[model samples]
Target: MSFEYYYITVVSLVIFIVALVIAIIMNSRYYKVIREYLVQARGAEAKGQAMSGEVEVLACPRCGYSTTIPFRVGDYVGKVVGETCPKDGERLVVVAIYSLRPTEYQGS
Candidate 1:
């Protein structure tokens, strides 16, 4: 082949190699960012589960009898629970819902 053709071929091969290297570097960076984000998201989810829980305070309207129980799904303040009070056979109502974590309202 002519010297011109050989030079052109060499330049083209070099350009292709440079483009391939750039693509690999960019892909590696993208994957690293995605991996870090996923790790952070998982850690946050686990921390949330470990840190907070809810409890329901049930009270009898008639007798002023109150008790605490683990909060169930769909339980809300003012909701009537299926269980009745031991004192007066009155239907118990959810008087309050609070988290297990200590907050500003809870004094030291």
Candidate 2:
């Protein structure tokens, strides 16, 4: 092969390598931004749910049917909801109030 052909082949290889490196860097940064955006979106959803208040587990004392209600203003953990259970038309009683939040792991 001629000397000029070898020189052209080396330059082409260098250009291809540089182009591949640039593409990799650009995609990595783009994907990093997307990952951060998704994380923030999930955090926002969790925050919105937390702001809605504690979860109230209600059940009919007669039929044992259960349901959940979101706690509101002036509502306490054991406050009986103003509605009755549809299963038996019995007054629904607050069974449990769950405050769901991320906490440190405590070994059981």
For model 1, name the residue pairs that clash.
none
Give the distance in Å from residue 90's predicted Cα in candidate 1 to where it truly belongs.
58
Displacement of residue 24 (Cα, Å) in model 1 is 1.1
Query: Tens-digit lDDT track for model 1 on 5-26?
Result: 9999999999999999999999
Write model 2 residue lDDT over 27-106, tens digit each, in one string: 99999999999988985775577555666677888889986656556666566778788777888888886666334233
> In model 1, what lDDT does residue 38 have?
100
Task: At residue 47, give the lDDT of candidate 2.
Answer: 57
* TM-score of every model versus the real structure: 0.46, 0.48
- The segments of candidate 1 whose C-alpha lies over 4 angstroms from its true place after superposition are 53-108
Local distance difference test, candidate 2: 0.76
